[model samples]
Target: MPVFPKISLRPEVENYLKEGFVNNEVVSASGKAAAERKFEALLNHLSHPPSFTTVRVNTHLASVQHVKELLLDELQQVWQFNGLSVPVLQHPDLQDVLLIPVIGPRKNIKRQQCEAVVGAQCGSAVLRGAHVYTPGIVSASSFMKAGDVISVYSDIKGKCKKGAREFDGTKIFLGNGISTLSRKEIFSGLPRLRGIGIRMTEPIYLSPSFDNVLPSYLFLQNLPSAVVTHVLNPQPGEKILDLCAAPGGKTTHIAALMHDQGEVIALDKIANKVEKIKQNALLLGLNSIKAFCFDGTKALKLDEIEDTEGTPPFSPESFDRILLDAPCSGMGQRPNMACTWTLKEVTSYQPLQRKLFPVAVQLLKPGGTLVYSTCTVTLEENEEQVAWALSTFPCLQLQPQEPQIGGEGMMGAGLSGEQLRQLQRFDPSTTPLRDTDLETLRDARAEDMIRLANKDCIGFFIAKFLKWKSTSEKDPQK
Candidate 1:
């Protein structure tokens, strides 16, 4: 059963998406009847959380089996229920991956005397596998003391004023927990923040919190995100470029896969996000990554000396592999209850993505790999862009992806069926939302859970292109 309603968007935005679904060729392939149903399913699934939580174990340090055993032990200690038993399973495709099905909207969880209100972002994290962070706490009952059991609620509409004594606006029950700090201790100074304010004992959705637990040995990333790094396949001792890499999730993974042997240059347009990339790289102990605040659209350094190294304004055809994970209107993200983007704002990313694609192609060496990806499900940002690239760049040709887990590319962008097959698309709506009432669905086996988890992932697209060697250009001297 669908636990949440269809994701709420502005009327204009909804109409825009609806038009795309109806008019798009791939969606309409089965005729208008099937297209409408698929569109509806997409909307419904967007509001609900995924069935399972995925953790990518850092195989560089600890083995997946070792981490799985440790994680199971931790869950046993944390859950400790007489009748309930939570299982941690390994992913079939990914070696260093663990999956845990989230048990949620549980029946008959009693409300506590005290109450604590948190933001929507924190609420979504709790549904997954996270503990409440200090900053997420928005309001608490006036007399709520330390050690008091309280019911946690999320302010979904962002209407709950911070530090308010009471919030009557729209809120949803998350779970129950015990307060770790007293009201005085939490709101004493001007900042009034320190440590964990609440320790969730009986969360509605039960998933293990891996915070600071095997940080080096395990990376907490979404399943689709893990697939992205694997698809890029950065090789050792090769120079690679991560255009628009902030927070450095994929960038760090690429370096790790290369055994920290090659130089991975990570660039982001924002200065603050660039700092975050550096911080994440340091945490992961990946020193090969060189993060900089630079516009990827202007990445090529024309007229620069060829001898110059380890600096900005890099010469054209410098990197062996390039990842253009372009900035996009993130419409495909799940559990997004509300989106405030105007139609203009939503459509604005196509031009920027187009501008970045040329530079990505230029930065790659002849016969090098270039992967273009986005988190949105829009035709303009995905298939249309691919069509444009093929038309504009004669040297580029689509390459087949290994471990093709996602569905083929959508049809509407005038690409032939053969051309569409080369692209990878993870569409969450295609998966069946398990019926809650069915005993088989409730008690699904581990293998079944893993399959569901993989299918029920965020909407994303990846297209890999191999830059063919041009006869006119001479080989570089070693």
Candidate 2:
């Protein structure tokens, strides 16, 4: 039996995904039955949260051990499970990371009379350790009052109407919590209130809230995300570009990796997202990041070849390293029970990702590195893109990643065995499912626990390429 419902997708969308996983290449390698099983496993894992939460300590500001001790103390203070403590483990390979186990799916809890329905996105957050905010509450019991214990549920199918007295459509229980906002307060016409509307008292999954805990010293990053910068290997005094950097997670990591001594230019198309990048940089006390609001596809400035400092319209081959964290359909986020996107919407990212690749390649200097990544699972977005890039740009050569923690690339994209080995694909479906109860976690060895944390993270893909040919040496495409 599955622990959670397999992530809900439209019939056509689901069929589209099934095709990718059960393709000829995958079936040939693993056999048809095995490929189908893997696809089903991926679906089951998508609706569940990662077993552990990963935080990247800002080594530029504090040592991993210092931050680790501080975090251990903070979590100790917040540890609320019958007084049994959960240990915070540091990664063996990722020196700047700390892992905290997420305990439960707590199936034993009984449902309560009063009910509250949160949006799908908010429900995913709850499973990943977040209180229910007011704005996320779509429906609540008409007579439910503050401080009343209520069973929380997610409108997994998005069929619930706002301010509804009760939702009768498809929904999934997300454990119980105490209401902090009554029905009137939540549905009040004046304005949608912010902050916690339901303080989770018995959440299905228990992970520490990192709202303001060591904000400057800890970044709530996934294990694979922390690996991207290590692959980029940004050096001090060198210039790097992070295209499509919003809220600047990888952008700041690049700056921190360089010891805040080099320029890390980050660009996102949205003004508010650019502001968020700037805000995160300020919050982390990283002074080396320069965020700009500009379209990455049009970032190259070949008309006038000159260094433009850290602004848009940069000359070709200017940045020592470039990171194209291209936007995609986002099929790989964990605890996501539903994706309402159409087939066209799901397939729309390939062209956009292709557009950003040339810009990243052109912006990178000769012998510089370019790392392209996405948080999606499609062959088109991950492995197919790699094959396309190799064919499209003769100057680009796929490079080996430093931390080879994730499995090799998927087999459907015509990439050779060696080429596939060079890529990293964090497929959650590969790991065996196991109980994450507190006792199970406590009894597990440290190495085994860390390994589980790594493979059970969000579905992500990364491919590193080196621009081997110098501008003066050849003009093959030009």
Candidate 3:
């Protein structure tokens, strides 16, 4: 059941998205009414988490089956401790992917009188299976003590003043939880209260928290993110480059797919973020990854002299494959109740993404593969970029993905039907929401959960291109 209204966007932002959905191509393909319905559906789905939690197994250390067994045992112990049982599923198409059902909108959950308010970011994390930490707590009942049951609300408008006694601005109830610290302990002269502030005894959506669970064998990741690495299809002994790699989710995944035998150079401009990539690679026992703090767009050198050591500023076509998971406007993130960005801020990423694309193409070897991806749903960033690349580079050709689970690329970018077929886009709005009540959720089967998991993922876009020797060498205008 739909517990909340569609996500609240600024009037201008809403209008912008509405126009994107009801554009000429979309309306001509699907009637105006259908396009309007999809646009509204997208708004609603953005406020809810996906129906399942996706975990990517570290196949470099253990087989998929082995990891699955260990995970099953660990989850079984957790469920037994909670006095409940739930199913852990392995995706049929994705080899190293595992799924866990999320039971939600639980009916008849009693509300409490005392309330606790949290920020938008904290609320989103809570909906995705995290407890309320002290730093996230914006307000609490003045007289409430530890062990007190309290209602939780999200400051939807971001108007709540930090450390305020109470907030009367726009706020939405998330669920209920028990206070782990007294109000005084959280706000008073305690040097710092950093751990969990509230234990979510009852949440609107129910999903298992993966904190400290199978740290070495499993990685909590979005389904489409895992797909990006698979589509790259790294080999056992090839050199790869990951541009704009930070916190290294996809970079580490590339190393695992290659069985830690090849050199994976990961680069990011931020020094702290580069450390995070190195940390993840070390935690996963992947030594093939070499991380550096440098801007990827400036990685190319015009010098004729060659450096013996394999590092940045190398010759053209130095890498066997390249992954440009460019930085984008993250409009596709789930459980996002509000966005305070202006129209200019929302559309500012395309130019930077385009600047990074040429550098990726220059680094990729002839007969190499390059995958460009974004976690946004706009046409300008998704399909328009593909159209731009195909026109600008004569040697590049679109390639089909092996396990194409998502829908075809969206229209309105002048892309042919065949070109769209080669792209994969995981769009949650296109999938109709189930019109069942709480009872249906209580009795949902494993198969139904699995089906929902595949379709109800974040809005993401992926396009793969293969670069061959340029034909212009033979014919100047070719």
Candidate 4:
């Protein structure tokens, strides 16, 4: 049963998503009832976190088994402290993935009047096993003091004003927690405390906090996000470009796959996010990654250069491979109880993605690979982009992805069955999580859990393309 109501989007956005899910192709293929059911399931799943917390073991530093042992030891301590136990399972397909089941919507979690309210983004993090940090806290009870037990709730509709005395608007209880700072310290203290504001003693969902846990050897990543790197299959001593790579999850993964022997150019428009990419690369001990703050849409240069150095705006077709994890309307993110995006905002990413696509194709060398992915379920961003690329770039040819664990591409994008087979879409709602208690989960086969970990992931889409034609031979009309 769904613990919360279907995700509350602006009425127009909701209708748009519903229509996309129940399009003519989907209805004709699955029947109207099944298509509607799938759409409803998606709405329900969006308000709940994924069942498994997936992490990628930095195999360059330690083997998967060694990392697993270390993580299990840490989890044991976490469980012992919290008076709870959860099984950690390794993926059968992904050599470097570790999965931990998330237990949720814990019944009878005691609520209190001393309430702490967090923003929607913060609440999503809390649901995914993060403590409520000071920056995320929107409000607290007027008299709420330090160390007082309180009930944490997410302002699902963005109705709670910052530092407000109380919020009565639509909110969902996250769980019971103990305040780390008094209301004054949070709202009025000089510079304000920046650490944990609410230590979740009883979260609606229980997962171990990964803060500073095996910093060098483990990267907390979604399962499908990790899959993109493997599918790219970067070889050692190759030059790769990651367009719009921040926090460097896939960039570092690409570097690790290449044994850190090749150059991986990571770019993001924002300077701070680029710094985060550098930081993550540094933390993972990956030296081959070069992160830059540059807009990817203008990354290609028409001027000829004698030699290609490691910077943006290089001569065209400089990279051996390129990964375009384009920005999208993130309708696929789980545990997003509500979104405040306007209809215009919801549909704004297609043009930006299109702007970046030509640059990605231009930067990729002949016979090189390019993988486009997004953490969203929009047809316009996923299958529609694929269709648009195929029509616009004759040099680009769709290729099959390795370890195709996700479902085939979604319908309503005018992609043929054969073409759609090459695309991967991980829709959480289509495959329901199998209910399991601690004992049953502990006794479950590792392979079974691995399968579950693959299917029941956040909504994601990936498509790999190969540049089989040289630029000279490319048709301008496409």
Top-lDDT candidate index: 2
Model 2 lDDT at residue 272: 99
- Encode model 1's per-residue lDDT on 196-309: one tens digit a residue: 788887877666677776666667777877788788888899999999898787888888888889899999989999999998788778889999898888777876656546
What digit string (tens of lDDT, one per residue) describes model 4 on residues 26-95?
9999899999998888998888898899999988788999998898889878732355567778777788
Q: Which ten residues in a row have the lowest lDDT in candidate 4?
A: 79-88
Assess candidate 2 and give its lDDT.
Answer: 0.89
Considering TM-score, where higher is better, how would the candidates rank from best to worst?
2, 4, 3, 1
Q: Which predicted model would earn the best TM-score?
A: 2
lDDT scores for all predictions? Answer: 0.80, 0.89, 0.85, 0.88
Q: Write the per-residue lDDT of candidate 2 for residues 157-253, one digit (tens) a residue.
A: 8999998989889898988999987788877754556778998888888888887889999999988889998888899999999999998999999
| Candidate closer to the true structure by lDDT (higher is better), 1 or 2 | 2
Evaluate residue 420 in candidate 1 and report its C-alpha lDDT on the 0 to 100 scale: 92
> What are the models' TM-scores?
0.91, 0.97, 0.94, 0.96
Q: Which is the winner by lDDT between candidate 2 and candidate 4? A: 2
Candidate 4, superposed: residue stretches over 4 Å from native: 79-83, 305-308, 433-436, 474-478
